[model samples]
Structure formats: C-alpha cells, structure tokens
Target: MSSVVVVVVGGGASGLTAALELKKSASAYYTSPITVLVMEASSRLGGRILPCDVPVEYESIGGGVLYERVQLGAEYVHGGEHLLDVFLSQKNIKRIPACVAAQGDGGPSGFQESQATVAYYCGKRKTFIRFQPDNTSSTEPWLANLNAHLRSLADDSNATSSAATTGKSVADGLPRDSFSREMADAGYGNTLAAGSCTLLDEGETRIMEVAWDKQASGDATPEGGMSRVIEELAADVCDAIRLNHYVHTIARDAETNRIRVGYVASYAHPDDANSAVPEEHANEILVDAVIYTGSLPSLAHVDVSPPLPKVVIEAARGSSHSPVAFASEAIKAAVIVRGCPYGEDSDTDLHAVICSNSLWPEISFRRAKVGDNLWVCGGFVSGTCAEDLKSACISRAGAARWRNETCVVLLEQLDSMFGDGGKGWRASAGQLIGDHDAEVVPPSNRVVGAAAYAWGSDPHARGGYTFPRLPGASHVRASLNAALWPDVRAPPFFLAGEACGDDDGAPMTVHAAMESGRRAARRAIASIAGRGTLQSRM
Candidate 1:
C-alpha cells in the first residue's frame, strides 16, 4: 500500500481537528499509512483562539506585578454535549458558568433563576433598567413581551412567512423602539441595518436541531480560558504543524491527479520596511489530498489552478449569488482594574452591563476576575461600529494605536455608565502603569493593564466570522459543505471550517468547526481509500 500525504491548509480549530481526526481515521479504516501536515500562516498553532498575557502592576499597593492570560478570541463554550465539551472534560478542565444572577429567587422553570444579571443603561433617559432574573414577570413586562415576540417568530409558521416576505432584516419585524434596536444589535453583533431576515429564519432552523438537548446547558468557559482546548487539540499533532508557512496557491496536477500546495516560509510583518517587497522564493509540496480550513474571505486570495466552482468564488468574494456571504468585522477590548469599577452598591456576582442609546449604542461590558483584587472588564464591538472603529484606527496608524484608542473608549464608556457625574473614573486618572508597548496613557488610575484585538485588521483573518448578508444567502452554507471536486471519483480537495457548516450544524461556533473538520476528515479518508463517497456514513 502506498503512503498517503494529506495537507491541511490552516491550523485553526477546524484544521487541527481535521489533522488529528485524519490520522486516527487512517489507522482505523485504511491500509495506507497517512502523513498529516498542518500549515499555519502565523507563528503560533492556534489561529483565532489567541490567548494573550497582560502584565499588571498594583502601583497604588506598593507595585506588585503579575502576568495574567486573557482570552483575546473565542472565549465561551456555547453549549454542552458537543465535541469541545467532551474534549475539555477529558482534559480535566473545569467548566464555569459564563453568567450567574447576583441576587434572584429560583424561577418556575428553575433555570431562569440562575440566569446572569444584565443591567441596561439608557443614556437618553439617564436611567438604569435592571432585568432581574426572578422579577421578569412583574418588573419588566416589556422584556417578557419582547422575548415572546422573538419566540413566535421562530416557532409560528405564519410569523416566519411574514418575516421572510415583508422584512429585509429581523429588526424590521420588531418594534421600532430604541430599546428593541439596541437589543438586536447586541444579540446579532451587528446593527439592525445589517441583520438579514433570511439569516434569522435559517438560524432558527439550525437552533431547533440542537435546542432540545442543549437548552438546559447554558454557555460555559474553561477554568482558565479557551486556550486550554487549543492546547489539548494540538498536543499530539504539534510536531506535524508547520508554523509561519503561508499557503498562497493550491493547484491540481491533471496527469498525476495529486494536489500541489505553494507557500512562503516566513511572513513579513505589515509594519516592516521590507513588507512591500514580495518574497522571491516560494516553497511547494505535493500531497494526495488537501483540506482547507481557513476563512472564506481568505480563499479569494489563494490562486487555484482550476478555478473553484463559480458559486464558491462568489461566496468567497461576497458578490453576486443567490445568497452572498459577508465577513463581519468585530473588535474585543479588555482592561484590568485594581478593584470592581461598579462601586460598592453593585453586586459582586454581576455578570454584564449593557448600555443603550449611547455613543456606541450596543456596547456591553462583561466582568471576570483574573486576580484577587484585579478584575477584567471587557467590551466587544461589531458590525457598523466595528467598521467605524477600524476606519478611525487606520487614520491613527496601526494596531498599537488602535489598542490604545480602544482602551480609552472602554474606560470612557465605563465611566459614563457607572461613574458619579463622571468623577469616579476621572479621579482615578493617573499614569497608566504596565504594558510599555501601549503608547497612550490611560485616563484611569484603576486601570492597571489593557489589551484589544481587531479581527478586521488581521491579515490572516480579514474579519471575525462570516454571515449571510442578503435574503437568500443562507443557502450558501450548504453549497460550501460540498467538496471542490465533488464530481471526481476520489475528490482531492475538501473544505472544512465554521463557514462550511450545513443547516444541521450551527455555524460560527467552536463545536461546529470541529464537527465540520470531522466530516471533512472522514470524506478525505474514504476518498483516499477509493470508497468514492462517505455522505451516508458522515
């Protein structure tokens, strides 16, 4: 039996999962010896699962410093009984609830009582609306009505049809109030203008597939962070991964029927003086099969010898198609404070603060403790807000400037929401110690460390994740699931990523990525074995 060489184009969760699964499948089912290689464009193994260390110094308390690893990407484990949860359990990684109510009696269902405390601040009214888990019925009738309306859109057939025909976006079907619009922005990670009604309808279908089993299990995070999952997934396959190998082209040899992969050995930093000069020398490798797990937007840049099917290309470019795919921009920023910034009256177990009708209409702050006294307040910006931030940051130069600007905005927003006449945060304004890389001095003395990541600015990942932009665009996901060479008896090219997930699988989740990888791996193995098809098996 001849040895089979399989090359995985990206080293993200999907790619790593594919490489590991391929090796395992080959041993279990095929006679040919399989060699799996993962090519990661960046210098690290994890693609978007970046865990960054922020060094914090307690200058007010005699200057004691410590470095804490904070999740810069893909922090939460969405549901349970998925591959990610299984992997984490096997690794003995503890799972903690992402949200918990600070003070609430158990609800009729028992689940609502444990729900996180979400404080809604209305900037226009200069008032705060607290959504207490136990008091949803009596205190906030509007919130309950909103929830019922959303559920009807998903559960009632007539409501779905009405939404599909009359509205361009999910928000269009909702009440035109500022509160409703703000809630939509926060939930969809995009402004109401960008939310597609088709996407919402399709998403509801996908949710139904797993909602029964997963409804009881809420969102969770590992004891430390998502980095633990990456570490465990890459443990056995680390040596097979090639870091700093940027794949440029993928071509198929008509005569030999083998796939040729071309890549550059090193990636030049965008800020480097010589970044403008293209690498004169390129490296190439021949493999029996190829699995691409990179972002859909990134596929447009890779030169395919025989162009991908027109629909795939259209999906990649977000151009003319029944349904177009758009890579949405998102930014995550976090700052470490010496003490709880919510003040003394605030609950210690407070989970998140959601602000509406403000400068950043849907900006929300999530709280987590990294140390005994140090707490992390993180905010995420997406959709049009993210695009605006990207444009503003570009005018200021590069990532360093962007990080500083983001931190400043975070502190300002926090102060505006929680500060007393904005004096609380302003009084704490001292020289922002630690993180010498940050050029801008923060305006708060409580801020000990700061960090931010703009996914739109990342060269490898042009945006955070992908979403259907147009009315019929949700169908593109099904098209993406098919292999590039589906007609071929033994297809050599397969696509695996969160973007490639089908209706049965939820897109844009870690478990979905892993499931796609597993499916692609099984198909690749069957193809190599001359089995021709694995659709039924998968």
Candidate 2:
C-alpha cells in the first residue's frame, strides 16, 4: 500500500483549481477518499493576476487606469467568457456593462480600431518564433509522433477553413506572400495565429476553444481586478496553502519510491530586488512532493535532487524564455493640458484618441471622472519588442483596437493576403477579429487584459502564459500532464499552469488551465484506485 495521497504544487489559478477538482470528483466520480497537498512558492497567493486598488488620482499610471486603461497586466479578459461563466457558477464574480465605441453613438463613445492578434517582439530573431501546436504527446519515447503531427500542420495548405477566422502570420499575409510583405506588414499577425504560435502544441488541446476577435466584443473584469477571481478560487483550496514558504529543492527516494520536497520557509528578508540576504532560515518547509509553478528563470535558479531530465529543462527554456519585452507606450495617458472640445459626456466612462505614429498624439484627462482640474499619470512600455503596437495605442490598445478605420486598413490587408487558413485571402483581418472579441464592454483596461490574458506578456502572465516556443515547449507541458496518468502505479503527480501543459499544443488561458486542472485531478483519482472504480456505477 502507498503512504499518504496525491501531492499538488503551486497555488496559482491552475494549482488551486486542480487540487479542488480532484478532491471534489474523488467523492463523486471515483467514489474514493483522497487528500491533496498544494505547494506554493510565493509569500502571496495570487500569481501575476493582481487586482489592487488604484486611487482615482493615480489613474492613467502604471498597470492601473481609472476609466480603466488596464495598462500592461491581466486587466482585460479576451476570450475567457466560458471561464467567467464557470467563475460565476462557483464564485461571487459579476460582469459590468461596457460600451465599446461604434462610429456614431450619440454618446460620443466611439473607438478608432481594434484587433484580435497579439503583438510582441521576438527579440532580434528578425524571425520571431511563431508559436504553434502539433496535437500529440512528446513522451511516448519516440520522435516519429512529433514529426507526423508537425507535417500535418505544415500541410494544412488546402486553403481550408479552420475553426478560427482571425488573421494569419504577417509572413503568411503578404501581398504576394513576399518578403517585403512580411517587412512592410507589422510584426504581429491575427489573434488566432498568435494563439497558435504561443500555445504551439498545447493549443491543440481543448484550450483552443478560446475565441480571438479584435473587432468583436465581450471582454470584461471582476468589477475590480483579476485577483478577486484568484482569491475566490483560493478560498476553496485554502486548507492546503502555506504562505511565505520559499521552496529550495525537490528530491526523490529510491527505496520508498516517494518524492521529497524541500524549502527554506522564512529566511532573511530582502528589502528590494538588489537586497542582500542572510543564510539562516527563520522557518522551513519540507514535503513528500512539490509542484513548481514559478517562472522558468525561477525554476532554473532552484536546485533539485536526482535532477529533472534534459528534455524537461529544455522545454522549460523553450516555452518560457522568449526574449520578448512588453512595451505599451501607445496606450499611454497624457496630462490634461486642454480637454477635447466635443468631449462633454457626463455619463461617458472611457474614450479613445487616434493619431499618426510620427505625430505622436498627446492625451490628457484620462482619469475615471472627467473634470477641469485634471492631472494624468503616465508611463511608457519601453524596451519592449512590439514597438509598432506600442506606438499606436492610447490607454488600452492591442488586438481589440480593430474598431478603428486606421486599424481596419492593417487588418483588411492581412486578411486579403491570408484569409482563414489563407483561403480567399482577399478580405480584412479586422472583419474576422470583429467576430472574436464579440462581447460589449468599453475598450477599457478590462477589455485589454481580457485580450492580453491569453498571451504571455500581460504582466500577469509575464509573457503570454506557457506555450511551446522551441521544439521542446510541448514536451514539458505534456510530460508534466502525463505524469499523473491513471496507468502509472506511483501516486499521481499532477501539474497545471500556463507553463505546465503538454508540448502537444495547448493554449494558456484561465479556462484552459482550469479544465486541465480538473482533468489532472480526474486522472489522478483514477490512477490511485483500480480502473474498475474509475467509472461511476450509474
């Protein structure tokens, strides 16, 4: 008989959800009793999706804005409606009414453009790695399966229509599919293509259910911030969490076949990023297992006994270490020197100012409540790789910017050159994007974060949640997911998180990650008991 039960690591959205689902389903589906241990790395619970209060005076500054410019963080929620539905069923979250500007709303709440594709720098790759998925496992102890799946994707050249109608890669959307087309076109492509590239193989997983429409609508927030949702999820799994515990190492016991987790709980405190620390531990934590939800850089810095495999390490790097920076200078707010002449809507909440890149239009009075004594706080998303998008936004810009005519020109060209799967290739990307972000919310901070949450760069994700970048990205996520399979004899080891998915193509969204956690718990419960007890009697 095995000692103890299943062990879950990380307490972020994925970890917490996985633990709860397993515990819940064991009683319902498996008819078995199960206990799960969650191991989180940070002193705080919510990972990057933090939703704190920003004074109205401080609106138009940092990652927070009043009329809600949702600077560069998990502010707007793109295609997470399904997840929102799930949250509404499970928590106290409520959606607010949003008004994305149409051309002639008597309200004057008109938008210039919108998009569904995410734009980020691929570093100097000159060729930014276009992430995509292969819909296969990386661990069957063979490379043939990988090769086969990739070939199928590459051969999807029948000019067929895919489930996604968004735009395509800039390279795939050129005038003659020419080099200049790739150059003249902006660095970013359609939202679906970006998801395909970001999630790589993981996108192949059910997470692909996400919709990516720039001109579309329906993105939202927790009426507050994304953290409220995280807090709600945490409430369910609070019994298993231990805060301020900094994990140090993980080990495996050859004799007992059990995993050992180690960490220094309370060590010297660092006052700042460059603060020095003492060696003594004020507190400590050790476990039989560990779930590492930290970033790739954080993972690389930690120590592990018996160590992980080369493939896992390689995948971690490929999936997380994209040299892309998050610049959002375009969506910046300006000091209200002189307010707009036609901007006198008492009930109006959010508004946009369109301008040429070279002219570099300046905006003022980006506060929640418009007033004469307005002072706007602002910052630039400097050093980021996607400089083009950063230069074109005001407050909340991005794929959702497709509502603008100026943005339509860019999207239309992209679609004409690379229609859904490059079929008709004569329409506009903006039109396709129109169908993705289909909900109705003013293109505020909530909308932008909703749009960016799926990608990794939204500060909350630190870089579009996890996806296969190099060849190994899929393997890491897949391997981790499989480790908890029912066929295995040892106690199941479940993994979830944008970073903890299969190399076989998975999209990183709270919804996808949540479903993954549920599947993991289900698989673990099935594996622990005999297969006879897997399916319910009913």
Candidate 3:
C-alpha cells in the first residue's frame, strides 16, 4: 500500500493539534498509511504558550529559594467545554476560577463575584472605585446607569446587521467617559478607537462572543499553565516535531505531483555563548499535503510557488477586505514582591483589578501567592497601549529594552495602586533577578524577581493574535479559510490557525486554533483519499 505524507508548518497549538489529529484519524479516512511531520521555526514547541520558571530568593524571609512558574504567553482558558477544556479535564489539570466574589454564591460560577469586586482606578480622581456586582447601591447611581447603557449597546450591536454597523467602532458608541473607554479596552484588547463594533456584532468576538451558557461559564486558568495543554497535544507526536526548522517555501513538485517544503535548519555553534553564530542548512521535503498554521501576516514571509489563490493572499495581506484582521499587541509582566500589596482590608481573593486613566492604555493586575508574605503581582496591557510600548521600544533599542522598561513601569504601577502614596514598596534595580538567575540577598519590601513579554515583538508569533478592525466583513475569515487550490478536487495546500476562524462566534483563542487544526486535518485526509480515487480511475 502506498503511504501518504502530510507536513504541518508552524508547531503552535494549531500545528501540533493538526499533526496529532492526522495521526489518530487518518487511517479511518485514507486507505494508505499517513505520515505526519511538524516543522517548528522556533527552538521551542509551544509557540505563544511560553511558560518559564523565574527563580526567586529572599534572605529577609528565612533565606530560601523557589521557582515561580509564570506564563509569558497565553494564560487563561477564556471559555469552557471547548477542546482545551476537554484536554485539561482529560489530563486532570487543575482549573482555578479566574474570578471569585465576596458574596452571593460567587455569582454564576464565580464570575458574578469577579464582576462585583472589579476595582477600577481613576487617575483623575487619584482613587479606586469598586462597582458592586449588584447595582443596589444608590450611592453610585451613575455606575449602575453606565453598566445598563453598556449592556444596551451590546444588545443593539447584536441586533444590528454588519452593513449598518460598518465603519463604526466600540469607541464610537461608548459614553464619553474615560472609565467606559477603559472598560471596553480591557474586554477587546484594543483601543476603543480601533476596536470595530461591527466586527464584535457580526464578525469574531472574544470572551463576549457567547452568552453565559453552560458550556462557557467564564474564563479559568489551568493549574500548571497553558504549557500543559501544549505538552498534552504534542506528547504522542513529539518525534514528528522538528524545532528550529524554518519553512521558507512551499512549492509544487511537478515531477512527483507532490508538495515540496523547503526550510532552513539552524545549528548552534558548540562554543557560542549567545548562539549568535549558528550554522544554517537548507533542506526540503516532499509531502502529500501541507497545512500552514501560521498567523496571517506571517504568510508574507513564506514563498508559495505559483502563489496561493488570489482571495486567500488578499485576505492574508488584509488588502482587499474592508475591516480585515490586524495583528494585535499585548504585553504581560509579573513581579514577585514582599508582603501582600492589597493590604489587610483589601479583598485577598480578588482575581484582577482593571485600571483606567493609567500609564498604559488598559492595565489590569492579578495577585497570586508565591510564599509566606511573598506575592506575585501580574499586569497585562494591550491594544493601543501595547502598540505605543512597541513603538517606544523600537525607537529606543529592542525587546530587551522593552522588557526592562516594562518591569520598571509595572513596579511603579504596582506601587501607585497598592503602595500607599507610592511609598509602600520600592523597586530594587540592583536586586531584581532575571528569569534564570536568583539574587542571594533580598531587599526589604522590594520586588525580587521580574519578567515581562511583548508578544507583538515575538518573531514567531508576529503579534499576540488577530482582531478585526472597523468596516470589516465576516467573509474575510471565510476567504482566509479557502484552500490554496479550491478548484482542485484534492488540493494539497491548506490553511489553519486562530486567524482562520469563521463565523463561529469564537474569538482568536487556543480552542479555536485547535478546532481549525482539526478541520484542516479532516480536509487533508479527505483530499488525500480523493487524490487516491482519482489516480485509480486514471
């Protein structure tokens, strides 16, 4: 029996999932044996789901050391009952509710509680405002009114058509209040000016996509981190993954009637400390099918012989489609500080605090226990804020400078928010330790370990994820989903990624990526079977 070979490019959540799905289900669809190969450009397997251990040492607190596992990339499982949830459940991974309330059964699977204590800091007021989950407090009638207005807007957007909402943005309809704009930014991961309302209504939506259904209660963080999910997906197909293999070209092999994948393999020099002087070797492989699971913008770097379909290329480039998908910038930073920053009266169980009118476009902080009197405070900034940060970093130097600057900013923000009059704690530049290293001596009431990641600057990802802009049409994603050779009954080239998600109402998430991968695998298997049938008939 003749064997079939399938090449999965970009070993991210989607790519690895595609390879694994092909390996498991190919036999049922195709009569011949199927061989799956995963080409990962980066040195690591989890493309954007990077989890690292930052070493922390505090001599002031008995002089012990610990490694804090921090997720530098994708962290939360936005919704439940998806492929990711199933994987987590199957792996027996712990699921920590992202939100919890001080009262009332924690409000709809603890989401209500999360919403109740959402502390918003007003830079203008120089104070924090908490919106009670239940709007019974007449003291803040405007808060309840604003919440109602926002809900009404969401409903109206849902009722309206894409054409009617075209050229409109979330900011366009938002109340002319800084807090309102910040709330929108926190949800959409983009500035109100750039976040398209039409896309949210008709195109892909984020956590707000689906209502509070049984399947999707609310967001949750996996116990071990998102890396666990990646590990689970790649467990069986570990041998198939080729890290540091950059696929530069996918062309048709006229002689064999198969797809030829050309890549460059990087080998680190034995004596190089920085591995900057690595050797590059060009390689090629012939495969029956190819699944390109990279981001849309990344397509620009890949050379496809004879070119992909015009519509597909257009969609990838965001040239033809109005309100096309754009790469979004999101930065995440975390620091291990001494003592609980929230104070004794503050809600210790608080999940996250969304800050408005702050240094960044939209910043949110979450606290997790690291050890006795040691807490890890993590902050997230995205949308316009992240873009500005990226630009600033580029203007100054590079990502390293960005990380250093972000660490300092995060420390300052934390101090301003938690530190009384910005004096509760101070940042120790001398004692701050990198992800790998640990400082022997600890400073009093200072940050010991700090780490930050700018997903937009990451070469492998290009950006945090894809989001639609104003005047966008839902058909753009459909165009992105088009096969390389749609006219062919058994096209050899296909595309799958979070960006390719269609009108499923699912946002660009890990589950969506996995689903796309599975879909691509099914198409590849069917195409392989169809090709075999055509050959036999000929």
Candidate 4:
C-alpha cells in the first residue's frame, strides 16, 4: 500500500481535530498509510483559544509572583459532554459550576451586595429577584424570549427552513416587534429593552441560549488554561504541525492534478523585525487532499487559484441572509482586583455581577488559581466597531486608554450597587447584611493591571466563532460543507470550522468545529479511496 498525503490548513480547534480524526480513521477508510499535516498561519497552535498570563505579586500577602492566566478568547465550557468537556473530564480537570448574581439596593444604605440575587433597576427604585434553582417562571424577560427562540429553532421544520434560506434576516421569522411587546408586558426597564433588543440576531440568540443552558448546567473552565486542551490534542501530532506558516493561496497542480498549498515563512519571535515581511511564495507543499479549517473572515482574505465556487465565496464573505457574524464586534477586557467584591466567603459565582446601568454588559469574578486575595473583573463590550475594538486591544496607546476608562466605569457601577454608607438599610435578619467593616478597595488600589482582546482585530482569526447575522446564516453555514466543485468524485478542498454549520446540533462552537473537521477529514479520506489514488504517492 502507498501513502495518502493530507494537509490541514489553520491550526485552530477545527484543523487540529481534523488532523487527529484523519489519523484515527485512516486505517479503516484508507487502503494505505496516511500522513496528516497541519499548517498554522499564526505563531501559536491554538487559534482563538488564548490564555493571556498576568504576573501578580502577592508579596504583601506573603506570596511570590503568581502568573494568573486569563482567557482572552474562548472562555467557559458551554457544559455537556462536548469535545472540550469530555477531554477535560477524562483528564480529571476540575469543573466548577458557575453562579450568577445580580445587583440590588441594600435598603437605605447605598452598599448593595452581589450574591444569589438577580437585580434590575427600574426608574429610581432597585428591584431584586432572588435566583431560585430549577425555577423557570421568574427568568429575565430577555432570557425568556431567548429560550422561546431556541425552542423554535430546535424544531426540525424551523431548522430545515433556516438551513435552506440564505438571504433572510432572523427578524423575518421571529419578529422583534413581538419580542419587544412581550418584554414590555413583563415590565422590563428601558435600558434592558435597548440592550436585549440588539443582544443578538433571533437565530443567533437561539444558539447563545443553547450555550447559556449548558452554563446553567455548570459551564466551567478547567483548573489550568484552555490552551492546555489544545496542547493535549496536539500531543500525538506535534511533529506534524508547522507553526508560523501563514498560507496565502491554494490551487490545484496543473499537471499532477494534486492540490498545491502556498504559504509564507512567518516568524514567531516578537523581537524578529522580519516577521512582518512575508517571504512571498517562500514555501509550497503538494498534498493529495486539503481540509481548510480557517475562519470565514480569514478565508475571504486568502486568494484561491482557479477561484472558489460562488456559494463558497458567498459563505466566506456575507450574504443578505447571512450577514457576517464579525459585524457584531466582540471585545473582552480583564483587570486584576484586590479584595473580593462579593466578599471572602462568597461562593464561586462564575458570573459575579449583572449591572443594568453600566458600560460593561457583565463582569465575572474568578478566584486566581495561583494567588490569594486575587480576583479579576472582565466582560464583553456592546455596540462597538471592529476597528475601534481592535485598536483598544493591540496598540499600546489604545490599550492604556481602554484600561483607564474600563476601570473607572467599573468602580462607579460597583459603588452605586454596593456602597451602603450612602443609603439607609432595613435592620432585619437576612434582609440586608451590610459588610461595612470590610475594607472597600479603591479602584486605584484594587486594579493592579489590566489587558484587553479584540477578536475582530486578529488578522488570522478575524471573526471569533461566527454567529448568525441574519436569518439565512444557517444556509450559508451549510454551503461551506457543499462540494466546491460540481463533480462529486472527490473534492480537492474540504471546509471545516465553527462557521460550517453542517451539524445543526452544534454551530459556532468548539463542538461544531471539531465535528466539521471530522466530517471533512472523513470525506477527504473516502474521496481518495474512491478515486483509487491512494495506490500512488502524489
């Protein structure tokens, strides 16, 4: 038996998974030995799953410098036995259940506590809604609508319709007018009305709701950084992965008829000034099959020889029905904080605070795995552009400005909800337990350092896992899996990524990426076997 050479483009979750899956299923599917290769454009293997390490010195608290790893990209396991979750559990990584808290007034005292409560501010009065486990009736208006939308999507009929229509907006099926009326009837505030109105597209919200449901079932990150998972997945195929090999173009060989992948020798070293200059056409490799796992935004920039099919191109760019998910810019910023805002004894709440009137949508407080009396505040930004968000993440000047502004806004919001000294409190047991004696760490003292990440800014990963911008996004996603060439003998190129919504059960998620990769790899292997090309080496 001869060897079948396979190349996987992009070293993200999908690409890595595809390579591994190819290796696993090779024996059964291929008549000969299979060689799997993964080409990564960036210097690192993990694409969007980045762990930004911050050195925090706890010398004052009797400890050394602890390198706290914060998630800048994909954080939180969306629960269930998805690929990531299964891997973590098998590796015996601890999974912590996330607790959600809302802000409410502490009686007359201005200090409000963030514990086991879901608070919403309406007009001048602060309303508190205690979180009850297994209770669904009291779900927030936004959450209720989201749940209903997910239900509709889960139905086979609706899902099939969505998969066929590639140019319809989500608003067409799930009208915003109906959603707004329901929220108004439920008595939600103006701020929430505006925020939830544009939270996500109707179908996009359905996907998010599915994730949130998993979180409620205890979505959590392992004790170590998420990059650890990537490391584990790449363990067996470490030798096959070529880091900093940015692919510029892909085409089929004219004579050999094999696939030829063209890439530049990218330098990973930060000090290396030559990293910016692409050694034009410096490197090329020919493979029997290529599984492209790069994101949609990334593929749009790369030139494909002989040109890709119109449907594939439309999926790469954006269609009227499937507006690019990248359009909804996502920005996450994290800052090291001293003194637990929820108190020392507060149970681990994945999401510590939900503020109705604040610049940040929400902030999660995590107890540092390495340091004591250490916590971090982080959240996503809404109504921001990709360029502005990207600038805040990359440029030094932009980062400094972003940090100061975020810290200031966070302090004001926290004080408004928890500064009990300014307001009176009802003296009743379990009514309002004011921890006034506890030292209130000022923003200056509490905020040791901060960092930000803008997914839209990344050149290799322009869009952080895609979402449905419009109703027909699902159809666009499905098109990615369709054959680029009209003949079905065997496609030279196969697509895999979160954007490939072939698996309707999981789209725009790690599970979807892995699933798509497996699907593409299997198809590629089967194609080679069917064509009887495995007998000869390319």
lDDT of 1 by residue, 310-337 (tens): 8778767757452545645777777776
RMSD of each: 5.1, 14.8, 5.3, 8.5
Better of 2 and 4 by lDDT: 4
Which prediction has the highest lDDT against the true structure?
1
Let me know the TM-score candidate 3 reaches against the reference structure: 0.83
Off by over 4 Å in 4: 28-31, 60-63, 99-130, 133-218, 268-279, 318-324, 352-354, 382-444, 501-503, 535-538
Question: Which model is ahead, 2 or 3, in terms of TM-score?
Answer: 3
Residue lDDT tens for model 3, 263-345 = 88772223211123223335888889999998776676678887877666664565646345554577887777665666644
- Sliding window of 10 residues with minimal summed lDDT for model 3: 100-109
Order candidates by TM-score, high to low. 1, 3, 4, 2
Model 1: lowest-lDDT 10 consecutive positions: 101-110
The candidate 2 region of ten consecutive residues with least summed lDDT is 101-110
- Candidate 1 global Cα RMSD: 5.1
Q: Could you arrange the candidates by lDDT from highest to lowest?
A: 1, 3, 4, 2
Expressed as tens digits, the lDDT of each residue in 1-538 for candidate 2 is 2233566656666667777776677667644444567656555666545433322322346545344323323433433345444775557577543332111001111122222111111112222111112311332212223223323433344312122333333223224533223222221212222311222232231122121222125544455556676777788878867665655555565675555555555433343322333344444333333445554434544455565555455544443344211212122222221122123342232321211121111111133333233322221112132243344432334444522322322323222222334321113122322333333433221212111121232222233233433333344456656653233364434455655543222244455556666667666665555434344535
**TM match of model 2 to true structure:** 0.54
- What C-alpha lDDT do the candidate models reach, one value each? 0.63, 0.38, 0.62, 0.56
Best by TM-score: 1
The estimated TM-scores of all candidates read 0.84, 0.54, 0.83, 0.75
Model 2 misplaced stretches (Cα beyond 4 Å): 1-7, 26-35, 57-72, 80-84, 97-217, 267-289, 318-465, 470-477, 484-488, 501-506, 530-538
